[model samples]
Target: MRINVNQTQCGFVMKNGCYEKMIFAGTYHYPACMGYKVIIEEMRGRVGFKEVPLKVLKEDAAFMSRVTMVEVPEGQLGILYINHAASAVVTDREAAYWNVWEPCELRFIDMREPVMDRNVEKNLLRLIAQQYYKKIEILPGEMGLLYQDNILTDELGPGTYYYWLYARDVLCRIVDLKMKELEISGQEILTADRVGIRLNLTATYRIADPKRLVETIKGVENQLYTRIQLIVREYVGRYRLDEILEQKEAISGFLAQRMREEQEQYCVEVQTIGIKDIILPGEIRDIMNTVLIAEKRAQANVITRREEVASTRSLLNTAKLMDENKTLYKLKELECLERICTQVGNISVAGSGTLIQQLRELMGT
Candidate 1:
């Protein structure tokens, strides 16, 4: 007997009750007079019960030139192929060939486990993503919120996530988890002493709970900013101008304490709060400068007057001592005469006979 198969077909032959191994397309001649059993199976990409071909094919078997083929791309789930003859699942960029003898069904599933949005997978069988893939992009030191149908579901941190698109009707909200600053500048407030002052404040904060952030709090940044501003006003409003200027550190501490108490409610934590500046009114500043200068000048004048009085009192005591003691009076007179003699460059008496006696007489007079 002889059998022929085309290149498009694979054949299995059973001879003498011993089933032969799987064979490919070709022609084979076997000895006659021996019992010959033949089974021809078609490789169709389908899953079902397939009937076996019993008739022994000589040269009359149909030849197929092309076969059905299915391919699965990388990063994709198993590809399911089924028909009336066979069923299979292929994984990881696999290529499969099936006979065209029957109808074949082919399907590719994503291994990412996201099937809620078919549109997302439709555009990307490999690396390319579709537009329907709602993106939750959180930069480093950032937090993200995932919501499905208006309900908060998951909190994400610092990475690109397909969860927003993988699930159906999901929405994403991103919050800055890094430290951020808020400023309140040129705020005109009235102190307890009825002084009008301009207060400038700065605050730094970061998000703590991303999941409860959107659900429990609204406008977290703005809310925190307003809280700081209000706290500043309250603290500064209670103190006088002098206290506010001198006790800026205390005011900052007060604000921080308030934020600490209320931070958890807003899902944010305050790193620091400070008074950038405490600006007085133009007239108040000029008055303060003038008063400071006048007070300092008064203190200097008092010191000068005290020193002069001390010197004059000391001179009076020395004069009293000289008057009471004759010896001291004589010595002081002699000292004055010595100072006078040194002032004159030359002292030449015309009558050189008794210069010392004449000088003594003049001194006595």
Candidate 2:
């Protein structure tokens, strides 16, 4: 039998179903009667010789020289490299590759840590299978809490994180750090005067201590919201409808003070809290509107009376001044005559007395 092996391939000679020798890139001749057979394989990739055992292949110095073996310890992954570039991930206990392609190497990565090295190359990570690790991404304005086996492991800031999923369960919870707005809308409460009102409240807050919040409190937002609702009700119930309407700021200040006192318990910083809207009952609103219109009418009447009194007083003072001065009174008559002439356009003074005396008599002043 004649076998031809190209430069990119190797051959294994088997004699009567048993391994004999390894041959590379050449033509060889053997007698058919000798039961010599050859198996050819491309030597540019992984090494797996099924016809011959690895022990048998390792016995040959030339075969060992042309192959690279990588041993991946338990609970660790092997990153296979060809020519200093990561090509594949080895999850098995051991792997082998042919040296004929390029320089073959392996980088072992320990999987025991919950946090992966930040310096790990993204190209190398792409070679790993998804099932072997869990990925968590925390965006800006968010924080990540990492847990392993239902136990808190570490707090992480905004970034991408990876954990080995083998032999352990992992979970990551994200909490937003930005200011949050909570609205308690359409809340019905009765005032001191038995006036039923619907109130809408807005509260702004931010997480001051996320670690304490998760460790000490469950449903922090709900707890905070309930407290706010109670405080607002308490303050509003103490005042009558009119008093409450006039003292919205007082209610806000009361609620704010109460929230500030309890900030440590909730692990949050209350930015602001206030009543957004105050809706009165239909009957109450109509009554208030009627009262407002009646009060405005009364004010208008008072202003008119005040102006009339001032005009009467001014007329009395002017009459006294004119009665005491004859020349001043005569000047006033002349002014009145000038005004009458401008308005009449054409006038005839047929009276025998002076024009001022006639004008005064005609005007009935």
So what's the TM-score on candidate 1? 0.54
Each prediction's RMSD over C-alphas, in Å, is 12.7, 4.3
Worst 10 residues of 2 by lDDT: 356-365
Task: Report the Cα lDDT for residue 25, model 2.
Answer: 84
- How many clashing residue pairs appear in each of the predictions shown? 7, 0
Best by lDDT: 2
- Candidate 1: tens digits of C-alpha lDDT, residues 138-171: 8998777776767777777787666424335777
Cα displacement (angstroms), candidate 1, residue 121, comes to 15
The sequence of per-residue lDDT tens digits that candidate 2 reaches over residues 1-365 is 88889998888888998888889888999666999888898886688678866878888887888999778998899988888888888887866689977888888888877667777777776888888888899999999888889898888898878888878899887888999999888889899999999999999999999877877899988998899888888878889998988999888888888899998889999989899899999999999999999999999999999999999999999999999999889888888877877897776667566876866675666
How does candidate 1 score on lDDT? 0.68
CA deviation > 4 Å runs, candidate 1: 1-112, 115-127, 132-137, 148-153, 159-171, 306-365
